[model samples]
Target: MSEIISDLNTIDKESIRIAKKYKQKNKNAAGSKEGTFTKIAFISISLIFVVLMLVVPLISVVINSLKLGLAFYIESITTEYVISAIRITLLATVIAVIVNTFFGIVASWAITRFNFKGKQILTTLIDIPFSVSPVIAGLSYIMTFGRMGWATPILDTINEALGTDIQIAFAVPGVVLATIFVTFPFVSRELIPVLNAVGTDEEQAAALMGAGGLTIFRRITFPHIKWALLYGIILCTARALGEFGAVNALSKTRGGTFTLPLEIDALYLSGSADSITASFAVSSILVIISVIVLILRNIVEYKVKK
Candidate 1:
């Protein structure tokens, strides 16, 4: 009789354990359903936001651009003024990208590789363009290089010596300068964190191995940062292309110094239906360029991750 009682007790404990496990699993299943619902809700909200803000505006621009028919749209973007604007915009973007890339590389290298006085100050100064408004930057350049400004005499002396009537304020050079000032920090900012993450140990080791500075950089540093640098260049190019306030402040000559953004503004401000349509047409060009740059940026980002 005692053996039968022991067997009964064992069977009862096993049944109780199985019941507890089933209860715990049901609780977890309930929690999992709630979690899945929350995730889906967040994703839906994000998709709605992107569709409303970005997709809608882009589609609207495209529709308006072709509203006047494809021939009219082509004519609007092919005008002499439009062509000049395109040329100037491309020129400024190219110059800004080249100059900033060089400066960014040098600045990033100095900041990452060395301990020096005013290093923090130098880093802060590099970021000035990001904090400062483009309009303010344009005005500052005007004040510095305008006829009555302090630097005017020096500029005049150089112009006289060079036998060239080169103009900065209210000219092509000024537009380029403004573009450079606004897009200055993109490359450096992109590179700094990357260099920091890479650390200096490898570079120091290569130096100890009697590798020349260039060799060390080319073999070790450049490989790591090339994608970052390309990413920065793409960003710089995009910013340069869209820059308006600074370029507008420096350049008032419509056909000579206007970029695509300025041309679009001029067309819109004319207050005619045709001009308004033309403005949208010009805007479509920028939209296309921006899409291309964005695609390139994503590709570079993917490469960086890989």
Candidate 2:
């Protein structure tokens, strides 16, 4: 009993010491006020220009989007082509997000939860899309899939073998493929750091608790990184919605290539002033979508952290 009391005293004394030390560190030391002011001044100055440049352009986009009137905005937002493009873009983005979510979980699990050959190389390969130009990204697909390209004969043969005509170029499927390729890395990269932080111990512990793979993943893994997953999904959706270079690169730029972006270009090139305004109107719609996604992501991430 005496030893127990002594131990309690020692712990209390140690805690008190720590609290005092922390207080001192946070106290107004001799030069801390000046140093603090200097740091604040430097950051304020540096961020001033960044805020001006970034915020002004963003505000302009929003202001322009709203300038055309609520009825006009509603009509613009609900127009047949705009609606169809939104549907197409959302469908492609959702499919890509789903595919990449699985890949993110699998790849991060494989990278961190196991060891294998050429792991570093695999990691580097995952980052290739980030460095590659969207234009070149589209070209690589074209080189493999276009009419005169290497795999065209194979595609043709397969279509004949199946007793059906199949054309991939300048179509919805091509746009989807481009979206998937470009947005592949977002979720995986987002999850890597989160997975690294969570580590394998909880996973192992779940196994010891008689949890199966699905149970282990659901109960132990998913919650830890759900925010990151959502962040990646929102970002990927935004990128896919705004994707222009790759879609333009692979598409025929005619009938089958009538995406909202392409339509905007065509309208601006040959149509009247109203069509040009409609182009900006479409752009303004996309910009609004991107902004909403970003705001949702911010809220979700902040809540998760809290």
Best of the candidates, TM-score: 1
User: What is the C-alpha lDDT profile of model 2 across 1-306, one tens digit per residue?
Assistant: 999999999999999999998888877574699898999999998799878988777777556655666676566656676666666667767787788878888898788778899989999999898999999878888888886679889989999999987676666777778888888888889888888887899899889989998898898898888888888778887787777778788765444445566656665676676555566677777666877987898897886676
Q: How many residue pairs clash in each candidate?
A: 0, 0
RMSD of 2: 8.4
Candidate 1 per-residue lDDT over residues 153-182, each given as its tens digit: 898999899998888988999999999999
Clashing pairs in 2: none
Report how far residue 62 has shifted in candidate 1, in Å: 1.0
Provide the lDDT at 130 for model 1.
90
Among all windows of ten consecutive residues in candidate 1, which has the lowest summed lDDT?
144-153
Clashing pairs in 1: none
